[model samples]
Target: MTWILVLVAIGLLSAVLLLRTRRTRQKNEPPLDKGIFPWLGHALEFGKDAAKFLTKMKDKHGDIFTVCVAGNYVTVLLDSNCYDAVLTDTKSFDLTRYSQLLMDRIFNLHLPNHDPVSERKRVNQYFNSSNLSRLCSTMRNNLQFLIASADTQNPTEWKKDTLFDFCYSLLFKAGYQTMFSTENDNTAKFTDVYEEFRRFDKILPKLARRAAARDELKFASSARKRLWELLSPNCFLTGSVTQSWMQTYLQHLKEQGLDTETQRRAMLLQLWVTQGNAGPAAFWLLGFLLTHPEALKAVKAELCSLQHLPLDKTEDTPVLNSVLKETLRLRAAALITRDVMQDKTIKLSNGQEFVLRKGDRLCIFPFLSPQMDPQIHHEPEKFKFDRFLNSDETMFCKEGLQMKYGTMPWGAGSNLCPGRDFAVCALKQVVHMILTQFDLELCDCNASMPPVDANRYGFGMLQPDGDLKVRYKLKKHN
Candidate 1:
């Protein structure tokens, strides 16, 4: 009887383990696949290359399916047409908790009145598309000054460095100065900030996932602390020309009774959000243009004709816009993630329905379908500078399933980036200034394009795994 009882206990324990480790699909749910691993299902494959893994999964199971990843079952939506069902449904979906979770995980940040919705609204008000005159004016001045200051040693002499390093470093400095005012264009000070930022950014993905090893965690923690010190309230307040938005944000934080430390952490988060993507984007845009000679010629021609600060984006430049559109489509890969607030059935625009369970995650990898799918974009992997232009160059190409927005860089609804217009203006500013004000070219024209760092598939701007050597010199102003 004792032996039988022991056997029964073991059997019951095993049953409980199986129940905890596995999942069962209820009616109307998406196709579920819990991989062979007990708790870490398909995490290895997914982490290795999310795009490739998701593509394989899409082939195996239709456009939508739930796969267990790192113990969480995430229902991924691949159909571009169906993204609205997820983005607009505030009652059933929530991203604020997830965003806050990342903040604590990555930045060690916790706010008193942590309301992202209200915060985003205030941010949008500052970054309003209708009136970006102040920010745009400052950004242009900073860009020109920084460009001229970059190589005071030799105006005509060609300076050489890895292109990605040059682009990101310069743009980051300019963007930093534009957002957080400084008494002087202290190149050394801002460059140090960008260096520390780069260090923190490299390990950010692992940090967010709670998967950083000993060395990575140590580096991230140290780098973040240093960043906090650099952008501390004292340093930030001393700046004479702090943007209005910064002033408003600081006042709001103080109203919430946040301490100096909390406010500093908040500033760091803002830095990451505002100054992060533009540089990498500039890198990709310039890299593509340099490699493609005809594209280089066309964009330069367009810049030559511009008579104003903000070129009538509605009518003036088509070639430059197309090139930018192509670059973003190829390089931007953001994983739109949301928490399933309740058990809700999501009906796709195509009329397919799938039930998402409460406590599960919903993921939309637009980079896979709408952005890079060959069916939607012809020769999707190849860079076609004119891919988005009509034959007469009157309208951007919006054929196939792209009845709405062709690419999703800013995402949708409340999660839609308020800084969208400003970011694009910044990119165009960088490209226009670089091409028209400086002479740049690849060191080795025949060398292959650098491979993208696969680890950053879900991150916003996809950085190249390897760097390309490039040379540039200041062009004589007319």
Candidate 2:
């Protein structure tokens, strides 16, 4: 009996060792040109400069390369034709897994498990063009209130206040007002929810250490419990017609047999969808405008002319569209992240083969790189409002300045940001309100909005580092 037990234990140990060895071998066996210490991989260099790491690899290994990160092998695809091949291929790729990774990092919502059909259906309901149109009035009203409440004239106070903080606060207030309009008084409560969310974003990617990772998950769970408590009906949906409407909607969903957790996740999805990228994008637009006098002038001129246009008039505001488009192109929050799921071969227009392996990540970093590409835009570093203008065309065409791989601020294809149109409208209202009523200039002119360090993590997100002094000049009616 003792000899039989010993043999069984030996067999189990041997199997475990073999599995580990196989995984390690697979990790090293990726078919790509890996220069020096491929086992150590690009881990150290990537950790140092994640934004430039891919660019550097592209420089050394041409358009495609395979590198191991965190025990996972990733393939990067670059260059224009390769970009088109992946983006335009609708059926072959899915962003769900990558999107799930981001959701886990940011929201702690325990989402990303729904069937793709259901997920797409739900998201489409929320962000369909008609739904976005329904949101426009709410966004407009919220913007008006924010503008009326902003500290416009006090020069000294404005100078001391952080522009980034002000933008975040404005965005938070507007977002809350728009979503929970008379629905809840727990604006402060929701603010805490978002702060906790941001806290998780700041911490998650750095959780490579197992012990630290466990602690973060523990804290995140506790935060979620607290949030659930605060989000009780009495706290969140109360005291108004909108609240009643939301309650009815939720009840209908429950009657349709959606689980309680799914309902809660759906509510969370609504909250973040409204407040996420648009707010940061707005902040960046304003900050960038402060640096460029010509852009500011163009915006002011366009805004001043729009005073005569009716509120419902959508067309003829060409310059406002220009400002909005330029801002999105220049300073969008977040970058494109996709994992190459198949060992696919991409054929480029230049007659080169870019071979990509399964399970490798191709991250398109938007942190001051794409916006400053000299090859795409002449004098890329300068904030030229007309940089995106179709110079040869007599009419200002929206689609003409577009470059396939060059204009990727909102990403591309089916994964293209759903909230972009709504965001643009919201931002336009904000910019119009500010430019119309306020004389604005950088309060701390020396302060700059630079790329956030990789160690800190909140880069290309709602982070505008600057101070602006804005003074309200009452409109003169003749």
Could you estimate the TM-score for every candidate?
Answer: 0.92, 0.75
Candidate 1 per-residue lDDT, tens place, 176-262, comes to: 888875564376779789999999999988887787999999999899999998887666555443455555678788899999999
lDDT of 2 by residue, 46-96 (tens): 665555676677667654556665455666554443465676553455566
Q: TM-score for model 1?
A: 0.92
Model 1 is weakest, by summed lDDT over 10 consecutive residues, at 392-401
Best by TM-score: 1
Show the colliding residue pairs in model 1: none
TM-score of 2: 0.75
> Quick one: how many clashes does candidate 1 have?
0
Relative to the unseen true structure, what is the C-alpha lDDT of residue 304 in candidate 2, on a scale of 0 to 100? 84
Best by lDDT: 1
